[model samples]
Target chain A: MTETPSTGQPPEFPRPTAGPPEPTRPAAGPPETPRPTAGPSQPTRPTAGPPEPSGRSSARPSQPSPRSSGASPAPDSQSSPGPSGRSSARPSLFTPAPGAAPVGRMLLAQTLFEIRLLLRNGEQLLLTAAIPVVLLWLLTAAPVFDTGDYERVDFLVPGILALCVMSTAFTSLAIATAYERRYGALKRLAASPLPRWTLLLAKALTVLVVEALQVVLVGGLGLALGWRPSGSPLAVIVLLVAGTLAFAGLGLLMAGTLRAEATLAAANLVYLLLLVLGGVVIPLSGFPSGVRTVLELTPTGALADGLRSVLADGAGLPWGSVAVLAVWAVAGLAAAARWFRWD
Target chain B: MPPCDTRGMSTAPAVEITSLVKRYDAVTAVDGLSLRVAAGTLTAVLGPNGAGKTTTVEICEGFRRPDAGSVRVLGLDPWRDGAGLRPRVGVMLQEGAGFYPGARPVELLSHLARLHADPLDVPMLVARLGLESVARGRTPLRRLSGGERQRIAFAAALVGRPELVFLDEPTAGLDPQARRATWQLLDELRAAGVTVVLTTHLIDEAERLADQVVIIDAGRVLAEGTPQELTSGVSDDVIRFGGPPRLDVASLRAALPDGSSVKEVAPGSYEVAAVVDPRLLATLTSWCAANDILAEGLQVGHRSLEDVYLELIGAAAERTAP
Candidate 1:
């Protein structure tokens, strides 16, 4: 590469009043033309640089002449951007045009990355996927509670699915985003040309990806262990999608506003509370009417209601639950959009 | 002048801010700061700890909302047009950003590449950053050195080929050679007409790379100028003579040639300050020769960024102290 002056000023560019003066030395090394070894007027050599004898004060000038030519290539040098060539034509996956297609692509790519990262994390994998599966297996095996005119697996499957969404969206994503904020990762991403919507959608997509895996594993376990779904398969899928959106949106809202440690505490607290109160383990219908009215507004209850209606009762989708989930999703996303701190 | 519009068919400043103020509760992080980064120029924001350098950069990046004043990057408000502005900006934050430990740079780059309008080749980029040897290693992020991780962050930032880039402490812990290489990458970016706004505590870096030196202290701009301009006004040569080898400073100050002032900056060392010709150095050497008083480590010099910074910071602290 051609060595340009270090001023960050292109030749012929107008000098801005705000910029610093041109530096006299490039810090490349001793000047390109070697200074006189002994006297001021020694003939400058083109190459074959003189060797230094250690501790010889004569060669040890206080300031080495700033004339080092062509910096020695380091082991970890970045390759210069080449002119438009063979590889340049192939567009990068994330650089989508400013349209829906690019936005969708960005969301898909980010979601996949998130899922891959979460699955690789031993702690997260155990909590989101393994723990739920283990919990379902253990809970269904015990005879502590009645099947309520249904198979024991029937009641446990939908609840486990709800737990999966909560784990993936509320707990894992919240913790991850909180840490990202604390560490300045999100602030770093904000510097990039990626759209804000693309960033949010990408994160949401990643949660959904993890949730998708959770659904397959838990749903398969439910079927294999004799849990029957009364609702149509299509209705179950719609409900699952809605629940994922709601939980992920809420996760974003919490992660964006709270400190990492605080988010971690709050998410886990919410998770445990919902586990007991939102019908994940206990049925909402079993609660008193006043309690049910309050619980209905929370995302957990709506997710559980939607899941239970589809998986246990085999009933058509409940519009009220759908509306509640939709409201949560919208509100969560909006709140996150307004309050999220990048650093 | 009202703001210069560079939106169409004009080469204008890439960033401009006027008296930018960002206050959080009782603490004002950025106070009455104004700066401009021309298109295709690299401006380094330099300051000591708690100088609000990062806060200022964050405001420019649109990540932090300023409580008062205005900031325009690429002629668009950063917060309002954050998404609209994203495709043209790149950022490399200081720490705690990486993919899952085992994810290859290829995979991560491929994912991030999808978010840009024009992105570089993943394989080529990986090779450039010296990640090719470990390209297939699938090493987890936790295993990489701080320097290696920094490189990964830098690679991620450039993956999008942004029009403007923000680098915060981009080379904090790198070895000398790695730092040089990173500087080369930045130089190349500027050559391609990309605007770079960066922050660093390294004075040598600010002296070498920044087109503009915007110095901040105690949440406000202490000074801004070209390196030469800042240093030039300070008295010229600082002639230091050893003592203990203790020559009486008053006696030496009297014996010094006209236009030189002497002060004891440190015990056993005295500084004779003045702008002098090369002959004055020879004259001093000759004077020591005649007196049989040896002045070892004797040096003549101009004020460096380090000296100016110390003085500026000292003055600012004194003014703000309770």
Candidate 2:
């Protein structure tokens, strides 16, 4: 509403005319259609390995007139090459014929598109980026909880990183996907050439991309605040990846199975509950032994605990935490695949 | 032109549905419907609301499973070979059902184009569909007007240049210009050797665009052919006039052609149904003249496609009425 209705290309756009509702017969109709000069070539940006085999359908002997206007749909040189793409010669993308793009390119495009959308949304950015960074600064700036041996920076960094992962992979993804399903976006996508499962794959990839950026920002702040420790870089990646898979699997499960409003409420509630009780901002050791035992088993608690062990404790790898994440990852993914409905 | 019948088509049809039957628990939506959409031709599934048009098309799009029947799209089973066929087929679901609410038209469409190997140029499509004005706006698709959203859906349906596209009411809420533009785009799709299967209740749309028109009622084909064949196929043309009701009907019937039937279809409305010609029309007027009846409004015409459709469905409804 804020933007004025600027006529960017009035000449190019076919404005509504005050004409009769009579359908223009295809055989003979007004020939005033000014063919808009098709601007330029859409470069086939090969995002992945190579161009696909897109040669099943013979390139339409290019429409002669494509018949212009009214009854004739104007066909230009840039029309799609229908039917053949995807399983054919993938290396010859230089003069890409019209057809189905490689599955890899499609997945990559969708992933990037999704990532841009996620980053652009003020709410998603708040949950995934702002909240975690703000939480990191707050806990590090003033020691809210007493830690006997560790500095606040040392204890809060790993835990807040876990918080960032959960916020993105579970809450943000679940809410967005639930809405997309509600709006029939997923159902529409199911009709496209991209397999439905690849959409879920793209979400997982988007989470990892966002999580990497979170690491740089939050981890840099922790370092600036005089935090120093060490853990195997590979171990950190493994933990984060496993945590992502587990959370993403559960996120899609909730999104695909629950109604949009239900997913929205449930995802936010679970995130808040875990943020308080899963040892992200609070220490599990301070609680009763019985409570701590149950907390350690939760995926959120397991991820945080494992991250803390690796970074703050300088451990090689937390196999127990990995085991818990693995179990959740497998079960959640299996269930999502089994019960997810596109409509 | 008289549309070629299925028996005349030498090549394999693009979409062939055989004895499709779909049931929703106890209510059968599609009951033994069989149809053949010839390759590279536009076919309109014309029907009233709740005539199982959506159900039949949805099953063809692989969204719903038919309880009984087989569907082949481009020589592949729609459900089992969905992955293989999806790349070659485009679908625009009813009421703009398949679009994400918050996504912009350009971004979503570009993403879809990438999924296909050779897609129509995105910017070109936008301009072609007359969506340039709203294309760059920050508003999500959900906030745009229904016509704009419909244009985007139309763009999505054609982006991949699929061999066969299913459009479920592609022009429901469009203005005349937009509707005409949509019809043009469909024509262009057909020109490119793509098969188009669209469902609409608009009589003129089917009459103007479809090479094959299938009149469906109660989930079955009542009559189907080119608009010419369908309208001209009925044996008798109706001669109708507004006159005083219930006046000497036997005398009128006896005076007209031997096979002609006359009746007062409504109060003060009479129709002489027969093989109408100038003489027959003249004879009916003379008969009215002789009876001292002033035919208020006299008209002669063959049944239009709409007339055939309404009458066929009315008959079907009576037979199936509870």
The model with the greatest lDDT is 2
Candidate 2's C-alpha runs over 4 A off are A1-98, A147-149, B1-10, B240-272, B279-298
* Model 2 agreement with the true structure over A1-343: per-residue lDDT tens digits: 1011111112212221111111222222122111001001012113111211121011111111112222433333213523222122221111112366887887898899889888888888888888888988998888888755678898899889899889999999999999988878888898888887687678778888999999998899889988896898899999999998899889989998999999999999999999989889888889899999999888899999999999999998999999999999999989989988778
| TM-scores vs. true structure, each candidate | 0.76, 0.80
lDDT by residue (B214-264, candidate 2, tens digit) is: 989888999988776787657566767798877767667766656889888
What's the number of clashes in each of the models? 25, 13
RMSD per model, one decimal: 11.4, 16.4
User: Which residues of candidate 1, in runs, are more than 4 Å off?
Assistant: A1-101, A234-238, A276-278, A281-302, A316-339, B1-11, B96-106, B131-136, B286-293
Shift of residue A121 alpha carbon in model 1, Å: 3.0
lDDT: worst 10-residue window of model 1 chain A = A33-42
Predicted structure with the largest TM-score when compared to the true one: 2
lDDT of candidates 1 onward, in order: 0.67, 0.76
How many Å off is the CA of A130 in candidate 1?
2.0
